[model samples]
Target chain A: MAERVVEARHLSKVYQMGDVEVHALRGLSLDINRGEAMAIMGPSGSGKSTLMNILGCLDRPSAGSYHLDGESVANLDDDQLADIRNRKVGFVFQTFNLLRRTSALENVELPLRYAGVGAGRRQRAIAALEAVGLGERLDHRPNELSGGQQQRVAIARALVNEPAIIMADEPTGNLDSKAGADIMKLLLKLNRQDGKTLIIVTHDSDVAEQTDRIVLIRDGQVEADRKLGRSKKIASKGK
Target chain B: MDFIASLQAAIESITANKLRSALTVLGIVIGVGAVIAMLAIGRGAQDSIAGSIEGIGTNLLFVMRGDSQNQVRNPQPLTMDDAAALSDVFQAPSVINVAPLLQGSATVSARGESTTTTLNGITSEHEAVRGWSVSEGEFINSSHLLGRSAVVLLGTAVADDLFGRHDGLVGETVRINGQPFRVIGILAERGTGGFSNENDTVMVPLTTAQARLLQRSTPRSVDVILVQAVDADAVPQASEQVANILRTRHRTALGADDFTIINQQDFLDTAASITGVLTIFLGGIAAISLLVGGIGIMNIMLVSVIERTREIGLRKALGARKRDILFQFLAESSLLSLIGGILGITLGWLISVGVGAIAAAANADIVPKIGIDSVLLATLFSMAVGLFFGLYPANQAANLQPVEALRYE
Candidate 1:
């Protein structure tokens, strides 16, 4: 009886590349619950990236309905979708896409700037950075920080908006094994202690095994949904 | 985002690429500079022409006997009697004074120095009517005219040529047509006027010149009559009155009068119109460069939009609306023109000063006029150019799809 944070009935996306039609997604259906740490895995051309894009509100499905945090958003306009992305879905790209030559704190404050949060933005951004163990690196630019530290700053940016879900696309794809493990631990902690819903898109099984659930996408549809070790909240409720 | 924030962001981006920003605004700077300098020079030329005309005399009429346009064959000469008739206040109410000039070129010599110069036969009233004054000694008087004395007032140029000095020439004797005449005064230098050089002539009593200097066709005949009006506003009335009296005296019908009354205002109006055309022509040419500068802005903005495609995408991904993107680009371009405009003003002023300096070095009496109106116009026009040229690139940036732009390499 857990509350669902994401509910996708069916989705399809077709992209026209010149004269040919390319089907990136078709009949995709998936659900993720609140406070869940889930990983979506698929091979190349399996449409996992397309699903992530749809779920993050960066793109709309050509045919299908999607509900993120109980709001039907598949039919929303680009501006409305942008608002949804700003308010409900935070994104962490694989490239650590922090703005060049910008201080870490300013990069984190960007979403709040767009959200039109005026006076308290600085304080909130600082708190988010401090939560990610980057309080001392507030003024350090992305180039000045280590790979692990850069990813932590990205996490802080994602967390600053307090979105319903943080979508991290291959969060550790560009990080070393040690930095990757640290980021994985941090993301898991946010889900476990702070009850934040987390959806990570990665092909690494080792990374998938750490999540509470793994949904494998094949040819734009969910091919498998598997639950691994017991989640802390469920175990605590059982006790 | 708010305007201030967008402006701040635009400034940040512009400053980040300082070299490109500077180069982009250089076109605008040159354009505005050209506009300001051209306008200043044009206005200066107009002012100098008007100044030279006014420098001669205002509210005065030059009356000559022949109507040159009519090609009058054997035209009757203007006479001293006609001058007396026009001087009668009952006949010409606007007339203030009348002076007759009987001039002839002669060989004048002083202390073994001789220069061929014009001898002007003028009564004492001629000084006030011509606005000419003596720097050292007195002008001809009634006694000099009645006595027909052999005394003369030296013009500055004549004095300088004959005596190597303009002042202290009084009591020195000079010869007109080989007849010795005492120098009574030195007339102050009057620079060249619209028609001729007033500084290169010698003045003598009318009776003396009529009796001693040259052979005349008639005893009462004069070369030209100078008429003065009460004020500048009385010129038209004074002119009509003088014409009527002359026509009646000459026994000629309307339009067949053998005389021309040249109003000083006519010369002023003609110069004003000519210089007006010159100012507009110069300004129009400069405005073309400004238009080119606007195109340069547009060209650079388009390049910037292409170069910063990913940045635009990133801003959009962060929840920037279309208007926000549009305004950001527009702000950057406008800021460029604003900076260029200020710098261009300084450059333009320097150019005008340089031009004035060159003119002064060449002994030309021209001063470049830089008015606040032109500066304001250049500033506002440059800014408008920036905004106008910025529209297309800004629109292009705003319409960029986030997904496509983010993917742009």
Candidate 2:
């Protein structure tokens, strides 16, 4: 049995929208093991966002238990959740959320700064940027870079802390076809070479085909969990 | 996040919006500058007043007729005899010198230039007791007072009024109330001191004035008796001694004496209290502007927090804790004020120096005083305003939900 990095069972979330109860999630259960690249896909209102938020530690489940990397985090307070997010879950957003007017090197070092990693921050951030093929663009601000380069910087920021899982939400949504392909290639490289578990939320089937498995959600429940390749180790080695 | 990172981030944010940051800092700059300049002017006025008070001879006592407005019996006027008694070493040992003055306003003409000015009948002892020295020729001598000769010493203003100059007036003749008196000396300028213009008086021999210019009902009644104590420490003793001698000489009871004693220190205390109040008043008005500046900071901070909502969401998603966001905003606001405070101090110092320059150009005796205490107070107070006013907006930023913030346009 491969070591499970994420184990969530029967999760549910209800939002109070001004005296109306809106159910965002309902009895959702999923599991992701170490070093696996998985894509979560659903329609706009199918509760995929809520699941991503819960699994990414940006939010807690209103009901049910969740354990990430063997720690029960379903009932963690806000600060404790923040710590878990810092140490375990790295995020890459659709908009390439590199801080404006900041150098790529500094943007990549941001996570290390928040994690209180002192003295060796520059070395680690430089290594991460180099891993994304942006070592020479370290001094360039976000606006000075191409859309693909900006996303690379975002990926570097995500990788600097070596989080257990990199959660990418439409990471290539705003890029051109060429840039999107390049970004996908870089993300897969990181997953395969470093054995980093990757979870992507995307609506593009082509992007989903690149992952080892795909989980489809509907009406706040997992509708299908499909495997497109062999087991985790074989898939990573084959890629 | 650590303090250094927060500070760096704050600097980056402020520099990104240069115009807005400068405008925000302008409010604080004006507030602190106004506060410092007002305090400096107030202190300068206080210092000039103190300087004039000290310029008057120290340890001096003024003996005047008591207040008789509410009294039934009229108070006896001070006389030359009382002055003579106070000068007696055995009777009042603390009394160093006593100079009797009999003064009245008169019209004096010299070289067809006439002006109505104060005429004083003063003995030779008046020079030492009043701290006025002759700038040209000689002062009133004992022989001149004894023989009751018509000799006069011209105060600078009177000399300038009569002859268009202060010096070279020796042996000149000036008429007082239709009587001619020779100008033997010109008195040096003494500026204004303690309710009277010292340079606006003309002096003549006491005997000459008594016999020729003005006469009283009593043989030797005088208007004021000026007594000098040995030193500052001897003023109270000298006052008590002079009061006792006058009570005995006039045969009046204690607490019902016919004379009043005024000391130089009384003027100092009164002037100090008045200027102290003026300083606080000026500073209080300036503090209102400082409060307004603080509100300006709060307003700008609130706007900044709203504008950076998406950035805050991104930070939180990237694993920034609540305090990290809180500290970033707080650091930005206080850094605004801190920079403003430093620049404001420079602005304030420049204003004080400018005021001093203007005063000097106007020939006024004021020098703006900028003390270190005021500088320190303005710096600390402005920073506190920034921090205090920054709390609400920073809290709003820290308490934002990442999902909603990320969704915000």
Candidate 3:
């Protein structure tokens, strides 16, 4: 009975490389409801990243109908897609992707800046950083932060806009086991406490086990979809 | 993103690499500085030349023998009669006064010293016509002209050269080419203004020069005539009126007048045009350096675009539009060039002042003139160069696809 956050039907993508036609995606349909913490598992070249990119509004599906929050995203221009990305979705990357030489506070405030939210930007940015237990590291640049701290800052930036969906691509890939566990726990806390719709693409089975649903991707199509029981505290700190 | 935020990011990026930014701005600085200095020097030269020309007296015209197509040998030169006719206000209404002159070099001896000096034959009104003043004694009066007196006025230079210690030159005898002539006056020293040296000549009456000094078969032929207008604004009208009178009197048709009239203002205009051309030429050369500087900006901006590929990708992924990236880079480039322009203007002003000081020390006539207009123009031009040259790189940054750029590692 929950409102569907993403309604994608029959998406296909073909990339031409000189004389060879490379079919990265066949036809794939997907639907994710509100407050669903989903994990997409795939091997390399399986077109999992491509679907993630499309759903995040970073790219348009080659042949498909995509409705994000009931708005048709297939025909939207770049600016409109950017607006959707800014206001409706947030992204976290394995690399943390924070602007170098910029403070953590500024990094967290970037979305608000793009949304034209000027007043109280500093206070809100501080509060967001504080929410992520990074209050003292607001002035620290990305290079100065630890791997876990950097990922925490990225998560703080993602949560700043209160986006309808949080999309992360290998969010813990660059971290060690312990830092990866911390990041996964933080993501779980966002899903539980903030009620965010979390969608993450990862190859780690242990990381996948913590999600409420697991969607397996192969050859640009969804191979299997399964609903998991409640989180079994896959991240040790979450227990 | 908002403009202020983008600008802040740009400023931070620029400040992060101080040496690179400074090196990048050097081209714009030198380009703009060279332009300012060239303009200042050009304007300064023009003003000084005009100042010296105006020193020769305003609204004054010189009528000299040009070419005579009808007469081949010793074509009738401007005579004292012609000067007298022009002096008649009824005949040439714009012509205020005229002085007929005859000049020749002669050995002037006083006491035991002798020096070769220019001998000018002029009447008393020559003082008023030439804006000259006497320092010691009276100038050549009407009586001296009528009596054909054997007397001379010693210019300060020739007077000093011949009679260094001798005083009372007013009544002293100074021989002109072995002919004894009484020294009547010593002219004031008015440093070289190119209307001949004011303090380096000897003057006698026009009648006496024809009678005893430069004796010729012709009775009243003078070498040149100096005509003064009533006022500054009346000069062009006065020149035309004088030309008309001379044309009618000589029976020469239009464009066939045997005499050439040169107003002081003509010298001013000619000098101005020469300096103006020089300014443009120098500014153009400097602008080439500016052009090169703009290219330098483009080159570095392209490099920056390449280096920030990942940053561009991340911003796009984080919801930055293409125009946002374009505006950010463009704003950074413009800020770079504008800062360079400000520094360059300051440096150019300093260079001009320093050069002016050196010129003053060396006794040069002109001082470098830096105008506010040049500064404002330089600033605007630098920013325009920044914007113009920055377009390609900014476009390159904006056109990157987020997926491709993110994979640029």
Candidate 4:
């Protein structure tokens, strides 16, 4: 009964390279409600990454409409998109795109700086790092940390702004099985405990299974949507 | 970002690329140094020349027989009669003194030592007209002229050359052009004058020099007439009045006037104008080097933009405005030039002081001075060069598309 935080209707994205035309998205339609954890899975070249890009506001769909939090996202300009990305959405990348020479605390403070939050940036950044269990590693740079630790710092950076939704693209694509499971647990905790809308795109069946709902995609179309378990809360409460 | 943070970042970035930044600043340093040094040297030379000329007396005028522009036209020379006529006819309140000169050069021998020396014959007024004095004995007087004595005044150099460390050769006799003449006085040292040594000269009474030394028939034609104005301010009027009297005496028309009258103040003005031109020329050449330095800054800045493309992308991704990028780059380039400019000015001032010290030690007339205005100008010029050359690369960085920039390897 929660309000839909993301709405898409007949969205399509096409790319032109020289004389060739490519379709990245084909008339995609979906809705993601608040406080829900959703996973998008597909084979290679299945337009799932493109859909994630559009959903994260990193790219725009070429056709049809997208409404994020009841606002038409399809018509938003680059600045407005950045505003939305800064205030409403946080992105976690699989590559752990933390600045190489900067410390973990500074990396987490990057979003706050963009948001023009001047005072107590260090304190807020430390809180975010502690939220990801990285309080002791706040001063370590990405090169000084392990792959899992770096991903944790990146996630901390994404979460520091307290956005409405967290969109992660293959959040555990580069990690081993154990580290990947640890990252998935953290994302699930953020969703269930914080009541944040979580949307993840991945190829791993284990990662897809941990989400509340799995939306299977193929050839740029949604093939199926299925609920998993009792949706975390119901199971935890023994309902 | 705030200006202070941006400036700090710029400083850090420049420090990271130490070699490139140093080389870029080196260009500006050399340019500003050259400009300051050249102007200092040129000004020193001009001041030395003007000082020496002014030392000869500013209230004096030289009336020569031929015009400078029409050297081919031969004219009759001024004689003793003409000199006397001017002394009588143009006896204005502004005219202080008049001395007619008959000049010739000869080899003089004393004590078996022989040296070539200039010989000048004049009356007692000559000493006042040229602002010269005697170091030993007395200058030609009315009594020396009336007696028509075969007496002469030896210049310091001439006396040193012919008499060799002798003290006061006033009573001694030296042979001038195979004729014996008594050395009545010794003239003080007056330093070099253009191409000749002003001190290596002899002075004699006009009547004695014309009648006895050369034995000319028609009262030996005077080569130059020296005139002294009563006051420095009266020099112009005195020169004009003397020119009129000379033209009437010589019976010459406007363009055909035989004598050339040069006022000392007018000579100084001309010298100053020439010095002005030389200063500009030197400054212009130095400015070219500064321009080259500016281009060097631009070239290095462009390379820096290429090297830091990924940094630009990262900053833009973190919400840096285009103006922030522009200002950061500008601050870096400006800091480079400003440092160079400061060093260059210091180097130039040190050079001037060193040269001045050397000149003073050697008792030379050169006086090199570095002006405060030049330092200020050089600083301003360096900043301008920084801003101008830093623009292209700053614009290039500011205009980078964040998406494409992030993808830059």
DockQ of each: 0.54, 0.75, 0.72, 0.26
Given candidate 4, what's the lDDT at residue A227?
85
Best-performing candidate as measured by TM-score: 2
Clashing pairs in 4: none
lDDT of 2 by residue, A87-148 (tens): 89889899998899789999999989889999999999999999999999999999999999
Between candidates 1 and 2, name the one with more favorable lDDT: 2
Alpha carbon deviation, residue B341, candidate 3 (Å) = 1.6
lDDT score, candidate 4, position B399:
80
Pitting candidate 1 against candidate 4, the one with the higher DockQ is 1
The CAPRI class of candidate 3 is: medium
> Residues A1-239, candidate 1, lDDT per residue (tens digit)?
78999999889999999999989898888888898999999998999888988898878899999999999999988778778888898788788878776799989998888888999999999999999999999999999999999999999999999999999989999999999999999998898888899999998999999998999989888899998767765647644
Q: How does the DockQ of candidate 3 come out?
A: 0.72
Interface RMSD, in order shown: 1.4, 0.9, 0.9, 3.1
**Candidate 3 local lDDT, B29-91, one digit each (tens):** 999999998889888878777888888777899888875344434445788888888888887
Interface RMSD of 4: 3.1
Clashes of 1: 0
Would you give the TM-score of chain B in model 3? Answer: 0.86
Write out the backbone clash pairs for model 2: none
Tens-digit per-residue lDDT, A155-203, candidate 4:
8888888887788889999999889889888988888787778999898
- List ranges where model 4 is wrong by over 4 Å: A3-12, A27-118, A121-239, B88-91, B102-123, B134-140, B145-218, B253-255, B350-364
